[model samples]
Target: MRIRSVVDVKTSLGESPVWDVEQQRLYWVDSMDGRVFRAAADGTGLETWDVRRKIGSLALTANGDGAVVALDDGLYRFDFAADRVELLAAPEKDVPSNRLNDGKADSRGRFVVGSMDTLEASPSGRLYRLDPDGSLHVLDDGITCSNGPCWSPDESTFYFADTWTGDIWAYDYDIATGNATNRRVFATVDTADGGACDGMTVDADGFLWQAHVYGGKIHRYAPDGTLDRTLDMPVRKVTSVMFGGVDLDVLFVTSMARPPLPRFPEDGPQRGALFAVDGLGVHGLPAHRFGA
Candidate 1:
């Protein structure tokens, strides 16, 4: 696949690229910059929203009216029409060292997120599920930095990546209960190529596409942990990716250019730029909402 830099606005810590199919736009976050951004699929008409805090990830509401964001300190409902963000729940409010990192909605429309040690000072990161009813439940703990979280096309398997460990683990997911069990390593990454695993998305064929931070590449794997293909990216900090477009064939990828080890400029010219990959001949599953 040929990759092209679609968004020129470099991001400090670009992550969480989500495609809004109805609007024909792509949404993403600059985690370290405390910002959210979206643009047309063609990379025109860019728009940005400053949440005034670190935005780890965000998913749209069930009706596409708003977004439930995993901010540095809490979960919020952001409405662009009113330019307001209403606090929904704070899963780690008391833990000042921990910040929301990466998250996504489940097939059942519940928001599940993970947190990470802000300074890598401790393994205090954990994962939680935010129910549609606004209830919070702890799913896992003892993580230093949590990143990718996605599910299989069959909806029976769930995957989560620990950025520091370079391991992407899987669980037997219970869609009805919002529970993930039977944790096992689903895929592994070699950081020598770039960095640890960062973010991910599953295609309609149940293939997992993972962006490798500091790795300068994205890897595609089959369900059984075999590497299917790899896309060598120009940036070392390839933060996250998602498939979006009228047919969900457009692969939108986000990267960073900031203070992380193996920083940008040294990596490549498009280190902090968002990229669009075409002719992949694959489509992604639709994203779920927070409270549909």
Candidate 2:
């Protein structure tokens, strides 16, 4: 498969690339710019949704009416038709240093989100599960940059990433009780750059695909945590990946332009761009949003 640039988003911190199967559109957020974008399946007809603050991630509801967004300060229900947003609840209001980051809906439609320090400071982040009925559950704690709470196809396993630690951990997932057990290291990255795993997705074949921030590539792993394939990217900071297209053969990747110390040239071609790769035959399940 060959990687090609689909569009130049110019997002300072592009993250959470999700495919809306029903609408045949791709949705994503510019976390630092506080912008949400939607484009046709072919990367055309792009439209921007301006939000009040940085949006971490978004999920379509079970009924496909609208989306539930994890904003910088709290959770909100977004009415796409009305273009309005209503606050649900703030799980981390007391922790002023932290902000909502990666999140997605579970198999049962419950939204799970993680919080991390905006300034990349101490390891005070935590993962929370927000049920449809508004009950909140703390799943894990003491993380610096929480990312990628992706689940297996059967909902029997969960994969989470602590970006600061450069470790991806796996857990035995119980969908019925919403409990995670057997925490073990699934993958680990080098300490030189501390390049950690970011957003991830499970394919129809049960393999996990993860984007590596500062690692300059996306790694595909077998179910048993063995390396499958690696797709090299021009950008240094890849944030997320998702499978889209009618047959789910196309892989969509989102990247950020910034690096830690010396940044890339402003005119570089690969930074903040949406990319696509063909020939991958793994299909992804539709995302479920919070109900109204």
lDDT of 1 at 181: 95
Model 2, range 169-246, lDDT digits (tens) per residue?
A: 899989887788898998775546545688998888888999987777888988988878887787777889988888
lDDT of each: 0.87, 0.82
Top-lDDT structure, candidate number? 1
**Per-model TM-score versus the true fold:** 0.96, 0.93
| Residue range 1-292, candidate 1, lDDT tens digits | 6888999788988989989877888999889888888899888999988899989999999874689999989999999777789999887889998999899999788998999998855889999999999999999999988888999988899999878787899999999999999999998787775467889999999999999777788899998999999998877778898999899998999988784433323567777899999999999988887887
How many pairs of residues collide in each model?
4, 2
lDDT for model 2, on a 0 to 1 scale?
Answer: 0.82
